[model samples]
Target: MVESSHHEKDEALAPAEMLALVRDQQRSVEGQIAAFVPLLLVAWGVAWLFGLGALWLIDGMRPGLTVPPAVAITIAAALFVGAIVLSAVLGARSGRGVRRDAATAFPAIVYGCTWSLGTVAIVAVGLGLLANGMDAALARIFFPTVLVLFAGLMFVLGAAIWRAVPMLLLGVWIVAVAVAAPFFGYPAVLLVLAVGGGLGFLALGALSFRHLSRLRRPLAGGRRG
Candidate 1:
């Protein structure tokens, strides 16, 4: 009886070891993604979506802003570089989780709808700014307030709902642009938005939307190790 019981324990240990080994192999495979190309992809995502329109505000590109062109350029460049590093690190990191069903897919699907509607509003705000010029009260109120508010929302959403690294960073930059806008003027602020906001979103949206499922797959398995 003792020998028989010991044999059963050994048999159970074999399958457990096999599962652990397979999980480790999966993590190894996923770690390989943290490379040069993935960083580029992350960089692209950030620039297009969030930073595209805002870039017009940067110095040299437009004259209305108060800050010197060189200073503005330096700030913008730093943000770009930082965003790329952050996104690449997040993307390359891997995890495991249970696979999703139709219900689970809804969050990603619905998130875009708000973004779509908000885009129209964002475009209108831009048009308003351009059409109204610097003197208009609405432009004064709209650009800083609306943009800051929007950025905050996106930051929260990116951090909370989507857990999107690019979006979260984009949100931070957006808030920064809003703070700088009143001091620098729309020209400089707009440039900041373009480099960080428009470009950030475009790049992030592409990367997150495309790779989110693949990235989430491992997390669902509940086995990071």
Candidate 2:
């Protein structure tokens, strides 16, 4: 009985077993940190889909077929604001109780602030140009395309930090759309944002969820075993 118990203990402490345990713990930590990612993606997807879609309907299509531009813009603004709020809340909640070294935390803090600061800078630049007599029609194309481009760059930065291939791909897609939007022109550009950017978010969110599910299954089996 003593030898049998010793053998079992040795098996548990073997290098392979130790490595597997560490891997499982790491996976668990990653899952917890990423739990809110899908929700954030979906929220943004909804915002882009309906908000930009509304603008496209009002400005891109026949004016008679949709609500006024004012109303459409208002709706879009509200949705974007809601998504921002949701992202902030979710991000904070995810970090609760998690400890990270300065190396890891610094990048995340800077990146988060970049989203806000970069947005303000872009808005200021856009408005400044408009005030300087950039044509109203041109302003319409300028704002959305530039903002989309900023978002794409941010995504690329985020992917670099996280080493996420999917995120990098998404960023590339957004950049492509932004670059192409100018050629599409005003209201038509809105159509591109609505269909391309909006749907991209939704699709990415779905894939994230699917990936998470697969991760969970193995963890669950391990726990059961």
Best by TM-score: 2
C-alpha lDDT score of every prediction, in listed order = 0.57, 0.89
Worst 10 residues of 2 by lDDT: 57-66
Candidate 2 segments whose C-alpha is farther than 4 A from its true place: 1-16
* TM-score for each predicted model, relative to the true structure: 0.47, 0.91
Can you write out model 2's per-residue Cα lDDT over 13-35, one digit (the tens) per residue?
89888898988987787788788
- Clashing pairs in model 2, backbone N/Cα/C closer than 3 A: none
Could you give the C-alpha RMSD of every candidate to the true structure, in order shown? 9.3, 2.0
C-alpha lDDT of residue 206 in model 2: 94
Task: Compose the digit string of candidate 1's lDDT tens values, residues 59-99.
Answer: 33435654554664565566666775665465445313435
Best model number under lDDT:
2
